[model samples]
Target chain A: MTMKYKDNPQAVADLVRPAEVHRDLYIDDEVFALEMKHLFASTWVYVGHESQVPNAGDYFATDVAAQPILLARHTDGEVYVLHNRCPHKGTKIVIDRTGNTGKFFRCPYHAWSFRTNGKLLAIPLKKGYKDTGFEQSEAGQSGLPPVGAVKNYRGFIFVRMNQEGISFEEFFGGSLSSLDNMVDRSPVGKLEVAGPPLRYMHNCNWKMLVDNQTDTCHPMVAHESSAGTAVEIWESIEKDENTKTPMAMEVIAPFMSPYEFFEDMGIRTWPNGHGHTGVHHSIHSDYSAIPGYLEMMVEAYGEERAKAILGENRHNTVYFPNIMIKGPIQQLRVFIPLAANKTLVESYIFRLVDAPDMLLERTAMYNRLINAPTSIVGHDDLEMYERAQEGLHSQELEWVNVQRLYDADEDLDEEAVENGTTERQMRNQFHAWKKFVVASMEAEARDLTDA
Target chain B: MTLPTRDDLIDFVYHEARVIDEGRFDEWLELWGSDSYYWMPLDYQQDNPKNMTSLMYEDAFLRKLRVERLNGLRTFSQKPKSRCSHVLNRPSIEAFDPKAGQFITRTAVHYVETRLDDQFLLAATVHHHFEMVEDELKIKLKRVDLLNCDAAFGNIQLFI
Candidate 1:
């Protein structure tokens, strides 16, 4: 069924208030379709991390904005994001989650093959379609259709449906510096996706996950069980100093702190719906333990530059429509919108290239503690999102509130500061959403662009 | 060195499964020695437990914390209780070292878990490294290599 929008664009604009959004945005299927076309399709959506397909013939398959895409590293050392469908019969190739294709991808159905880069190689019968007007040499029809536009920012890849507009740096705005801060922390200045990600489908809107990334307000309320459990573990270990490792300290320390601590650390909201929150105290408690890392940074960039690299501790940075960069843990979670109610979250844990084993282990422990299936912290979040989904089904309420610190003034500089408890981040997200959606609608009306 | 007797190892495994299925966590913890390690490696190349991360790398302290939380009345995930069943088959004693008094038993494990209305099954190769201590069988290492170890997952609170 088609959704009927208000005839006036200004009336449609009024649906999103600074402190609240209409509940229809979450439950209406028509609005979801429009969001996929305008918000997801037009904006640069995170595809996958470069470390995922490091070697030739390595391919990672996933869906973005409800479109099936396969990110593959070709034999030529270039990563390509191609449509998963085979051109001949339109069957999906490479059914497995991840595997090395050796040299090329051969469709199991017809045995039609293509290079690891997705260039068509051979067909089953050469003479079958000789007179059928099928042109095999034309790369347009036979080869796998590549994503509209692909760009990589510091090994993190993003794809956009529209070829023109702002560059990825411009699209990311202030969030781009967060990526730089992440990579710079590693002495070698590079990071790779360590292992396969844990894939799960959540029965909630994708926005819930995005919001929760920088939503410091919910940690104390939602994750009380996890925080309590962490404290209990810390107390048990305190009796025996021998068992209290640095890695365990990293995992337990964050959870044991009071909610007021995180609020006092402050938050910074950037344009384009990107923001970060955390106490910028220290990246690592024991930076001196990794002498080799410290030496490399000091040698290449000097001690002052090294200090700046280690000083940034912005916990989680949200990249607008889909991705959340967790700098402390070196983890990234990308949300792929499946439906209004269901979202597929693909998480990747990264290892800092050439860093100390202990450092990597610490980062991995953080990932396991927070993102793992058995995480005490995540259970509360999953429950909350599920409840939010069910609560939105009510016919009585037409709007959802984001009223915390709603009237507070916001900083518009590159490093913008806002009250950590404020709904400023949510407002920023909606402002960006309106800009993209309305711009697309206006562009469509003017040029009659076909998508 | 030769593999352990298939029947004897299968009996041991089935008993262990029963303890977990019946929610006898304290009894389940008794199967391990003081130095026992319960490790679930995150990736294929994870070589050293001290350096690389594992899904569940617990010593006695961490194990105690897990048990305490599981037995805690406040564990919200466990409020309704998660029901689980283990179906063991295709037991293969991959390797054994009698001189070292250790044996490696590999078996295919199909575990299904249900909470409220959610149900999912996991198929994996479970490797149990057992050692003879004081003439009694004790688990040195319990490693589960899941079929989709790298896939995104929801909360995995209990041991598999």
Candidate 2:
């Protein structure tokens, strides 16, 4: 199958601009397919944390732009990201999302075997192929195609399907501090996955989830009903001397914050569509200190540095297309694109190693209350995303406006630090989106012409 | 042992369901002891609430918050209001503690909830650990093992 649009980079590039993006970017089938090939397949997508697959033979399976991939810890203590397909007949070796494949991966279809690092070990009935010319091919030698590049930064693993882009550190730019702050929270500078993730699917484009990460404008409007209920209930309790404010109300009441609060909170946009808001402090600041944890931190890093580390409270850090990390709350949401209109979100909670149990408990509580599939606050966000996808199907709405703060800070450098309520982050993402798509399209066109 | 008769236990379970089905949240609150726990584990055989995940875990304070939100007119998901019916199997007493006036009863329940023409059926094994204080049986712990606890769920605005 041939697509003429692949040759015309300008057609894809014109879909995105500094101030607005065409609805086709989210709704069109061709655009989604291009994004999967160019944007997702060509960039450094987060696979899993090294802590998730701690021991030898432990494997975590996931998709990189619809390409089934697995991250397995080999016996040599190195984690390798490999294609999940058995090279012999293209059968998926790892069916489960995550498990220990033991010493090596044994394909259920045939008796083909491979090492934990995806090196082909043996094929069934070697005598039959002995006389044949099938001595050693790429399929017989290498069981599966290992990911192009696998890098583990402070236990966070990122894999690139194609080795066309820059290094992960170069890709992360200034946004690396967000991850630094997350791991540096612990005195030992290590973190662990709390447990199995809370997995759910939404009927919306994957970009919608990414856009919502730095969007400070939606909470007040989208969650008006639920937040208002919490406020009303809280006031009634305050009026009565018998009752007290419920701790759970803290989760919902923050959604009722006036626009001015978010406006002043500030947003920071880095290179490569990486951006975050609520960088100064958040509602987590209001909670009482985790008992004795501060002393442990101060002892390790001294008072000034410990204070700085603990005070860096970021709401959500968008790592381009697939990952968002909430440093203070100790949670990460990974978006997996299933199609143009469907995305599967897997949310993982992290625990700071050697930290007080109270801290982990608080984070776990926040995950349940805020990110759980049955969460009231999360339901409001899901409703808006689904509605946006459904509403954009109309031909009347061609352009989705991302014009806030466009005139205020047209300068690229100055735009990095803007008001939190500004849609600068969204615009910045589309800027990277255009760059990635156009580059990939041009590369494919070059290959075709050369052929 | 001062255990409630099988007939008494059946009546108690039915009346509890009636309170929830009829949207009598205030009356439902009265059915629990002051130091009671309402929890639904996120994973099968999930024992520790503090260490692991739970679909729902509420002490009296959080439970009160949920009730207040459901009754508040501004609760949008509950705007059209949720109607539910609970089909409970015959109660089986698991244990009886004479000294502490406590009894553990187990039952299988099929809970159907409808709101704004959208309906969901949740099947679960319920364990009600109650104590007989004087003649009143108050729930000390209501643990629900949902058949699909780990599955993706929409807004669960009201009590399960």
Candidate 3:
């Protein structure tokens, strides 16, 4: 019997097992192509922050699954996600990284113009196409193609490819609460991308980064140099008679210890592959002791609510595939996949909606330590990710194990943990991966059959 | 406080470049005031230092920390050390404040560096905010506005 394209239900099922993942998933080009079509093309990918384009005619350029996309703010106060390709001759509308198009985006090639909202405004030499089937009223060929769907959660924006499946709220599930946890801390309940994001490219696979964000086992090892520096600074400050201790130093000291400190603090893996690791239980003593954070929180929300916001201590919260948010520092890192072995990570530092200047300064300091190229912590992880990419080229291993904490009892029905350093997070990601992949393949098969 | 000659200001630029090129970091540190500021604004429109974020913004304390780390034995990226040569030209004295005993000089600097056979050429606008301290001139601020601040940059091991 001939197997239909969608008939490979068994092959799709094999993608997620309780124990392991196929090695070819990472190394095979064919599998990567399938994933782009199935997973990335179906799920909602984070495009950019709404604060990036705050004014009318403001637009930011980004790429999703190799397709150039533009997120623009219309004059009417609506945000739109549209293809960057110009319909006339298919040239890109905006060539610059980011800028205001004034009233419209004018294509330099043929002088084709488009409204800030991507409506076709004018085409140079209209008489040249008099007999052509081009109609001014036809929305199809005149303007830029709109994305399948655009949704905003708070100030963050996301675009999906399929426009089907679960609603944004349903798809985010409990992870949506993570954004709330971030915004609620702000007195104004709003945050803006404070400055131009720092963009850097790494010579490693994109997945390696997503995995490392919540690994929970690498911080002490990866950041030892930074931790040591922090410790030295802290000690010197303490020894000085006239020096006052800065809260930034206190925030950096706990990270200098052995990995066991983080492992002991444990991890909480939520449903939908979202997870948090490292000191999620206790608030950073340095920050909790600060009167500025306390006063601001109390003023924004009542004392009871202030306590609730201040008490949450999530270190790194992975929003799956693309975004990893660090709540304590108010920094967000967005991962954009360039190729099978290349990734671009953009780091944005946010000033809390009504927080103190010192608070923002501390947050910026954290970003400098962790994400900047001068960072001792950043270099270590970059080296490891590069090594992982090179090592995966070996033809020896056929599967990578995800067996850590496989036997641990679960506090949440969706997660299973055997120990603090379990591989359950990896497994949860694979589960979500398999679902998106299979669903896309099944849709393609149905399209083929209908033809 | 009187304004210094344009020739003297140009000579000061060359002397500053020599201090960095020779890796006289200690002496380089002495060129700046105890409460000196270093800033690299992200955009041209940035006006106030407190409101906008910079690519590199460091007070005296953070600057000392950076220098300490660069000279520290455990700085892995600096294991082999970085060598740089700076070429300065077009020294235009933008403004001078006689009342405050300060001056603002703008110059174009072309900086080239090599570390382990990797080379980088950066063209930037260097702004010197200077003040007189006792008998010597000190830098209150040195802001470098690079043409490609947003591009993919390699490890910035040394001060630019």
Candidate 4:
């Protein structure tokens, strides 16, 4: 039996427009549910990196679409993304966020056990339900249900919960290169998760964070206190003759780059609400080189290939519904939607295998300074998000605007490219948000009609 | 010349909290010795800050930069200005080394930071590593570990 996907998709469709979107899209309960079902659960979301669960039996448990899910490396050495559930009873099998399950996952409740690949091993009493539905059902023996598909492109494992929407290849398409670029930067051509991520709670809808990725306009204004302050202090230090300004200042100054700088940087949006910034140059492009980072790259890939790998720096890549990656910086931030009004942003940096220790340190510095819960820059953005969440509740404003460079981007293809200041990315995102969310409902309706 | 006793060491812990709570940031700066660090770990039993990500890992440079940003007039987020209050369980003097001039104190505290109807209380265990810099007690390291360190937290605008 299938769920009667709650009717009236036009309500979802009406919320998004070419240049503006309804305030309800950011604050409404109904829209959030539609998103959780049609967009998040249906599509391929980046669950975790393969390096996180490298050895056999290592598992990383997390919530996907508000359901308990874990990525485990089976004894067979193939990684499987499975529902972190016990089929016998509904209790969660693994409690630890991440650990090795050893030989198999043992249930704390019923003494039932499962293989790492989600195959039911044995129950306590084998003859208890000999004649029941248990003998006829595949589900009884199939321990934990895996997600619809798992695509591990260069160690970035993406899982789609159900095969209701677009195929993984069609869903990702050209956007896969962003993940490729991140892995290619590694001297050994591999990346590993540094450690547990820094999770910051936002009291706002998740889309606000998604929209913020290509929102090149806000950093100069919102981070005036943070990155702007760095500039002032560095200038003060510069006035003294003997002092050379610190590397810390250089890390933050580009965020406060002028409008023209961002305009020159540019943005490119793909078909399925995926896109990237730093077309000409990213905020990361100006940083002082780490001592041995480029040397390691050159040794690995020679001059031209290493130059291309090091030279091309993308600021942020939005993989639709949830995650964003900064390829050059070797960092990823996932916006896990907790509720209509709450989101938990888990930010993690990757260690390029065999790269300079300073590169990881530099990435850590950026993570703490920009993305951490205590981040001086992130505080300003969080403040705005909270205010927007609060203000959207008012009866006054019905719609939110994303009209910057709207007209300019009209004459573009399936892959739309525009200036950094353009709201084309937001337009591209909301357009997909409507298509994914509405198409699911329409498909359900068509099913009912065909039946 | 008076030798610093346990009472004086306890006073230093309470004084540090008051300085931060009262928002006397410049005065707070005077309380730190050179090469001091303020660390809030991301996970329980987090061993080192250099290798792993932290809730915050700040040196003098970052600390000053944070203060400057908080004090900046153009920082729209701090327009209302965040304020904090420390409800401390009396400090326990863990160790006293007078010869090498080092003192260690631990305190369990409920730190509340609030601004414009948003008030969040943080349950924390604070470990302060102190060293006497020219006879004046100064903090060498302040490590704050939250009970909910593994849990998601809202943006912390003020220093703990």
In order, the Cα lDDT scores of the candidates are 0.74, 0.81, 0.72, 0.86
Error of 2 at A352 (Å): 0.8
The better-scoring model by DockQ among 1 and 2 is: 2
* Top candidate, metric lDDT: 4
Clashing pairs in 4: none
Residue pairs whose backbone atoms clash in candidate 3: A405-A418, A408-A417, A408-A418
* Per-chain TM-score, chain A, candidate 2: 0.95
- How do all the candidates rank in terms of DockQ, highest first? 4, 2, 1, 3
Among these predictions, the greatest DockQ belongs to: 4
| Error at B12, model 1, angstroms | 4.1
Output the worst ten-in-a-row residue range by lDDT, candidate 4 chain A.
A1-10
| Span of 10 residues, lowest total lDDT, candidate 2 chain A | A407-416
Model 1 sits at a Cα RMSD from the real structure of 3.9
TM-scores for every candidate against the unseen true structure: 0.87, 0.93, 0.86, 0.95
Chain A, model 1: TM = 0.89
lDDT of 4 by residue, A62-132 (tens): 88887889999999999999998888768899998899999899999988889899888888888988888
Q: Which scores better on lDDT, 2 or 4?
A: 4
- Candidates 1 and 3: which is better by TM-score? 1
Best by TM-score: 4
Which regions in candidate 4 have their CA more than 4 angstroms from the true location? A1-5, A137-141, A238-242, A408-413, B1-3
Better of 1 and 3 by lDDT: 1
Candidate 3 global CA lDDT score: 0.72
Work out how many backbone clashes candidate 3 has.
3
